[model samples]
Target: MLVALGQLAAAVVVAVGVAVVSLLAIARVEWPAFPSSSAR
Candidate 1:
């Protein structure tokens, strides 16, 4: 039971980490586009 709980915790941590990383990546990609659009 302890091992299963540990695995679940690890999975949750990994999922959250992935989500954060993806959001940062998307923000970085869009960061430059925002200024160019506004400049027009």
Candidate 2:
């Protein structure tokens, strides 16, 4: 039971890490179109 729980925790951590990486990649791809804060 403890091993199963540990696996579940690891899976959740990996999922969150992937999500964050994906978001960062998307943001980097779209960054050029974003208006510069300094331009305001």
Candidate 3:
């Protein structure tokens, strides 16, 4: 039971970490595009 709970917690943490990393990566990719678009 305890192991199951621990695994669940780890999974949640990993999911959140992946989401945050993905969002940051997207933002990084789009950052330059925003400036160029505005400059147009």
On TM-score, the leading prediction is: 1
lDDT of 1 by residue, 1-40 (tens): 9999999999999999999999888766776656874457
Query: Whole-model Cα lDDT per candidate?
Result: 0.85, 0.83, 0.86
Identify the runs in model 1 with alpha carbons over 4 angstroms from their true place.
Answer: 31-40
Global lDDT for candidate 2?
0.83
10 residues in a row with least lDDT, candidate 2 = 30-39
Tens-digit lDDT string for candidate 3 (1-40)? 9999999999999999999999888766777656874456
Candidate 2, which segments miss by more than 4 Å at Cα?
A: 31-40
- Tens digits of per-residue lDDT for model 2, 1-40: 9999999999999999999999888667766566673246
Query: What's model 3's overall lDDT?
Result: 0.86
Q: TM-score of predicted model 2?
A: 0.72
